[model samples]
Target chain A: MQKDASLTTPAAIRKLVRAGDYSGHTSGFAPGFVQANLVILPKQYAFDFLQFSQANPKSCPIIATSHSPGVTDMPTVGEDIDIRSDLPRYRIFKNGQMVEEVTDISDVWRDDLVTFLIGCSFSFEEALIAAGLEIRNITEHKNVPMYVTNMPCQSAGMFHANMVVSMRPMKPADAIRAIQVCSRFPSVHGAPVHFGDPAAIGIKNINKPEFGDAVTIKNGEVPVFWACGVTPQIAIANAAPDFCITHSPGHMLITDIPNSRMAAL
Target chain B: MQKDASLTTPAAIRKLVRAGDYSGHTSGFAPGFVQANLVILPKQYAFDFLQFSQANPKSCPIIATSHSPGVTDMPTVGEDIDIRSDLPRYRIFKNGQMVEEVTDISDVWRDDLVTFLIGCSFSFEEALIAAGLEIRNITEHKNVPMYVTNMPCQSAGMFHANMVVSMRPMKPADAIRAIQVCSRFPSVHGAPVHFGDPAAIGIKNINKPEFGDAVTIKNGEVPVFWACGVTPQIAIANAAPDFCITHSPGHMLITDIPNSRMAAL
Candidate 1:
């Protein structure tokens, strides 16, 4: 925890990961900076993936992407980013299946690989906490409960799948406030898509999630669902791109851009 | 309905009301202008009621007040406005009990009366309609169902009572959109206070309401509750002021101010 507190800046955290010193999840590290989900794929599938992101902005809001196919410097999001080594962990997928989990991807770096930085929930979670709302996952010390809903995403070329959502239990009053707070950050999955009955969205059981661990839902609290960053991953896997890479579940690429800069209003 | 279409402007509606030509409810008339709730109290009770409104803004957001006692000219809200006869109808109360209902209060006008213009839900209702969300009350051709909740209002001098909330039935997805739409108009009760189960807010039966007509709650729809303008009236009645006047339930004081002007953002 002390080490976590020491890595306060995005640059410092990226430096630690680049030096092979820190290889853990980047959840609470670099508090105020924006942490993004990484999705690297061969340039052959870049246009279709970009179209899919635009069609489903709520599920996959794109913040920035590789300047050209393998040029690794994302100056728009960070100062000097080495896409292969800046993140703590990376997952390599071959033919729609994860083949290897590695600390760095320098060995498999391809000139035609396109890096995508999609917005993550961590930004809005930080905003919600600052507004004095309790996130159930944070309180229970577990991953936010994620589920694949019957709500389908708009198809783009060959990329198409059902939307994935992450749930957080909140009292109705708090949920109302969360909507207002999240609405300002449209770049990060703006507002919740649904609340109340989980079965209404095709979730048979609230206790059993398909993707992440379930958190406690108190008596009066309702489960509010937001379009998760994981939706694109599911779509990508379903598309069965010949080669692709993504940051591991909780690990993400910390950016120099402040979360406040993402506000729409 | 043709007459309503003719009376499209706020000034025209106020003119008709002032001339004793139109004495009907102002809902759906003068669509874009702000319609306010009227609360006229004697100078002796003005300070306490003002304090009460300030303490509970969500329930009683004050848009304007008379410049001074006996001064009916509210130039800020409109041009040459007469507080006594501008509304379609008025209700007079004596020692907390309703004594009479009339079209014009000029006959009983006093030099000690102070006028208070409060924000009404009509502003946000317009916004919801513009956003393409159906307002159940409007669809059913009934008054919005309102219930007296266990939620307590902050006590101010000689003013204290339980809160009153107006309910609108909507699907969870539409309810989420309503929260965002209403949040922009804080002067008109802002966002919904509670949603889902009525028992959570102390309403025993969803169909039975203490005030206004109940609207239908469809199969997948949930009851969304917002702090109502009636809350102030309830508090004032509970306080039992020596003499007071207010607009009749559906009769509002139409102002020249546009509905968009009420948006906080």
Candidate 2:
């Protein structure tokens, strides 16, 4: 879709997505607003997932959850946000496997489903860019490279899996500044987990990522890794839930909350 | 002297230093209080030095300055703080070179002298230790390794010199945590300026530091460097004023201010 001044507001962007007009990745729309990763599961698994999110906040920082099971509206993040159809796209998971990708899940919506709004890297990336640091993946026009690490998340009931992290390369000086800037917004992965060698965290290779395309790591640049929202999706798959839903990779749910409100300081 | 419970207070420690009963380094003394590096100069150079500090804050963070030239007391930082005798030891500089190391500078005191109190690493080191990160220099009983870097500071009038950085080695994860904790105390050199390769910041050998004893950089640990308070001393030496006084290396001015008061948050 062509970028325009009218599409700069979160309300406008979500209106487009809800009307089945813009179903692509919501990467650069509504610049100053927050965009979140979506996760929906049955009521039977809600308590365990909430506990898991609390335990591994860096990876699964929940911005808001459905007021109650069976509620289709998430009033906390945006006005009149329909949990079933507001996001541009979502993946339906059946028995630990993704069965279908669709623009809307209204047809499969169930009364007992619970929705969670998890924090995304886009918020901190905006803060970094505002602080005058270049985000490599954004500059290269690619999704952030992600890898599964040996670090295990605290298990909550049936949920258990190793952490998944997203990588961004920067000079050591820039990395220090990035840490300072990102530290202000703990809800969105906070500071980087590791910055130098990938092998220390169990990643076999820097160039080959398990998800998303690899960006260039310039000379003198170290690969800085942050806990990724994809981590929760891995845990859901490992649990083998009978029914689950998540925003398709890169297609996030735009929220009315301004990103600046997320700064802890 | 033995570190008795009574010496834990800054006032008690300063009383001993003031009486010439203790002329040794002040490390590990008055544990929870703020310690400051002292710089006394003629009124002629005060404005320029203040500008230099504003320009290079990370290196020469000013915690407090004398109310005016010739003022012997600093009511802002401590009670009855006699600028001439409160510090454990003072270094007298003549024509930019060290002339004498003495316990008291009252004999050479002049009405034209101005005193500056710069934040020292001791405050943030306490914070880092409290956060459960091991400081290699403290663990090994050595002064933090300081290096003269090629990075130039923004010059103000006659004051101009390269930045000096203090190094602490830690694993990547610990370095990230250190960055978060140190960012809270900007007055105490704040967060690290660089981490990982020492050569990236112009340090030729990690094992050899220009000032302070070197600590071991264990395997899997990266050396994190913070802007050092010693940077101002280098600037003073380069300026080559007619006369100046500074705290002796590792001997600081214990302040009435609690270290927690320095947190920017």
Candidate 3:
């Protein structure tokens, strides 16, 4: 998969994914644009998830949502985002367990299904890279390591779980600069949840992350952690409402909005 | 003695000081404007001091400086400002040792003296107060507690010294908010340098600070430390130039610019 050449534009990439031509990971695709973590739920659980996101904005910054329960086109984020088939892959869950992975969910899409577009780390990562900081996962060609921490997310209704965090190894100096840089982009998991020790957050092993591949931790680098998009997924898994769908890991929905537009400052 | 009533405007206060009518501290005076820390040096050392300030901006953010060697009017910060008599009191130092403290320095003014206006904590203190955060020094009617730290300032030319920091006791939650608030106003000794333990920065005694009066540190409150304007003063002391003049402690020059004008964001 030539990430640089194939996916230059969001609409062009979405067309390929919709046509079943491309179905691999979407990291490093559509540079300078916002990519989102997708969460599709039945109308019965949509209100609870929305409330959960509102309670924990730093962990779950909601970018946009479907206008109606069945409406798929999120006109605000991009031109024609068909929530059911635009993504590269979808994971179908039944009673909180993954049932199957499918290319399109049009067969299972119901009239009462709702789609949520949550802000992902790609935007802020681009900002950090632009500021001349090296991301360990990107450099090592591995997924950014993620861990489920003891820090619990504020529960709204039946939606509740402990927060999940993504880790990036950086020296203390770069970590300080990263804090200042990310503080400006509140919509994309602003600042960091914790910096230094892994045990402080109840992570027993720095090498064994709960999700994503472990990247190299250099000599002077401390693992800097940010509240991850996987948090809402964890909450959804806990709630487990009959049926739900989400993009397979790394198959994000790229939007037309540029990454810089997300900076709150 | 009535701080709120005595100093209504910058010009009026300058007039009173010029006529030898006011000779006290300017801490509570000029309620809603910028009050600066003054350091006057010979023309030979002006460029070096300016470079030091530029290198250590968090400690010494320069608001304005004398256009030339002996010119008095700092028309940029205030109008018709006689740097000799505008400040309440001036300390004349010969080879870095204090020789005299006088209400006016006109008779001793030289052609080679250069004036610098460094940003003081008063502006951000006002902002913190407006945000409903209590300033311990202001509440207790004492000078803000300051300490000499192991952290060394970037040296330039003959100017070099360990950094000085001012401490304010705040709960962890309040400290986080303070960091966010102070980040907006970069000129006025922005965001804290270190928070949790004083020993981390080599401050042996938290209760007994090196420079200013000690304030109460309540239960569950961690000492938040900011890079102090005294940093430049310490550098100047180390440099020990032939002669220098500076505003007496707490006797700053009240500038015409409003405090709100200093916020970078």
Query: Candidate 1's residue-wise lDDT over B1-265, tens digit each?
Result: 3565667888888888899988888888887999999999999999999999999999999999998999887999998799999999999999999999999999899999999999999999999999999998999899998999999999899999888999999999999999999999989999999999899999999899999998988899999999999999999899999999999999999999999999998
Candidates' C-alpha lDDT: 0.94, 0.94, 0.88
| Per-model tally of clashing residue pairs | 0, 0, 0
Q: What is the per-residue lDDT of model 2 for residues B1-265, given as tens digits with 9 covering 90 to 100?
A: 8799888889998898899899999898888899999999999999999999999999999999998889999999999889899998899999999999999999999999999999999999999999999999999999899999999999999999899999999999999999989999999999999998888788999888999998998989999999999999999999999999999998999999999999988
Tens-place lDDT digits, model 3, residues A80-153: 77888888989999989999999999999899999999999999999999999999999988889999999989
Q: What is the TM-score of candidate 3?
A: 0.86
Better of 2 and 3 by DockQ: 2
Residue B160, model 1: Cα distance from true site in angstroms:
0.9
Docking class of 2: high
Candidate 3 displacement at residue A109 in angstroms: 1.2
Give TM per candidate: 0.98, 0.98, 0.86
Interface RMSD of each: 0.5, 0.8, 4.1
Q: Can you write out model 2's per-residue Cα lDDT over A105-183, one digit (the tens) per residue?
A: 9999999999999999999999999999999999999989999999999999999989999999999999999998888
Model 1 misplaced regions, further than 4 Å: A1-6, B1-6
DockQ of 2: 0.88
Give the runs in model 2 whose Cα sits over 4 Å from its true position: none
Using lDDT as the yardstick, the better of models 2 and 3 is: 2
lDDT of 3 by residue, B1-265 (tens): 5455656898889888898988998886778999999999999999999999999999999999999999998999998999999999999999989999999999999999999999999999999999889989999999999999999999999999898999998854466567777888888888778765687688999889999999999876768889999999899999999999999989999999999999888
